[model samples]
Target: MTTDLEFVDTQVHYWQPSANDWYPTLRSRPALYRDILPGDFPPVAGHVHVSAVTAPRAFLDETRWLDRMRHDTGLPTAIVGTIDPAASFEMIEADLLAQAESPAFRGIRVFSGLDPAADTTLELFRLLAEHDWIFDLIARLADVASYLPVIEKSPGTTFVLEHAGWPDGEEPGQFRQWREGIARLAAFENIDCKISGLGMALGTMDPQRLRPWVETCLELFGVDRCFFGSNFPVDSVAGTYAELITAYREITAPLSEGDRHKVFAANARRRYRLPG
Candidate 1:
């Protein structure tokens, strides 16, 4: 099942349990709470070939700490740091500059409310634009609409939606709402979607159940704008890292070779500005 395509795991997580911010939440789930550094990540097995990775933010305001992890074996090609939009510009600037010092620092993942009309949110987007850094969003589906105006304002900035906006809830209506929300955000050319983290929502890695969501993302964003993310360790709750990868590969097997390349790797490389 192996393919020649190179993979950039855009949302893999690696951190020591000692990291207070994450330890408390993860401690309840020891299987994942244990330290997961790059060394634990095995190379290609079957179709799950991984060449590089993009590390998502774990503890907010730990960019410098997170950036240093790139020195650890198996760390992501780019580390998506977190920013406090509510913080003063001086503090944000200092953090941003420090994060940029690391070659692995590629962008910021924000979990805060993005009031497209908020001056702070707008300012944050401007800062990202100025630095050519990406805005990796792990936001509420209800909040997607608020981001539209902001994206329009900062056409220069890139926004990668995390975990398919993390659609959840057992009801069909919930999924319908997520689809609509995704569609609206996908309409903005500045926005890109990462197909990962659904395991957290569904608590399983059944590709058949996930196919529609994955396909919808590709159909909406197209191959060039859509990408895959492993969301490892966290998503490990649903299945092993390899299982998630295999599921994605199986679900997308019907696509053209070129399109498959984009979803599995190329789009991530380009979106995160990863090097060859």
Candidate 2:
């Protein structure tokens, strides 16, 4: 049963001491956050740590916490840190370069859904290009359409659209908007998609319910451009670690072993340049 697939959970989150116990916000719900950790990933070769939206000032602190966790848990092969795209490019550059010494520092994340039109987003995209770092775009379904210009302008930068652009419910119009917006963004070649946050968006812990969106992303982004993510702790409000992974496996079952490997691990490793 051992396929040559390298399993890497591309999106997972953890809480830092400075942050107000947000993990509990999700874990307070039943059947979530039980016996979870980097080691809980079954036969996982690696994983990427994404920053949680905490107090705005805590972004760098979150990265520092992840750095410590990477050393402690020894599983996050890559990290996507948070940054204010609105900040001066010089300030952003200095911060990134300071953290560049950490091997896990692979990219930056902008919570685009918060304010897509913020001047900082454009500045952040420009800085991301200068640093040659991946920009993890966390946008709401409505805001996904607004990121196209930034994506187009920064052709040299690699962008991973988080949670399939955070699509909303299965309404036909909503799905169509998501499909069309993502299709346009995918044409940029520099953009990729993450099949994460399905449970949270649908307000259900069930994976079967998420199949339509996941399938659409696979078809639109292709396995090579898609990656698997647990969105754990946050998604813990929806399902457990094992449950999330099971959902991912079920959604990706139709693909070949090679494509499965790419979605589960290879693509993330290549995109983030994580250690093999």
- Predicted structure 2, TM vs. truth: 0.84
Q: What is the C-alpha lDDT of each candidate?
A: 0.72, 0.73
**Each model's backbone clash number:** 0, 2
Q: After superposition, how far is residue 19 of candidate 1 from its true place, in Å?
A: 7.2
Compute the lDDT for candidate 2. 0.73
Candidate 1 residue lDDT tens string, 1-276 = 244666677777666656534445555677876767666764531111121112333333344555555455435567776655566767777777777787777777755534567777778888988888888876568677767777788888888888888886647898889888898888888889988888888888888888888998988888889888777777778887767877888899999998888888878778777776
Task: Evaluate model 1: give its TM-score.
Answer: 0.87
Q: What is the C-alpha lDDT profile of model 2 across 1-276, one tens digit per residue?
A: 133456777887655433444344434445653434565555577778887644555666666666787888786788887665556767777778766667788887866333555666666677778777888877665665777766677787888988887877778898888888788877878889988888778776566788888888888888789988878766767766677777777777888888888888888888889776
lDDT of 2 at 9: 76
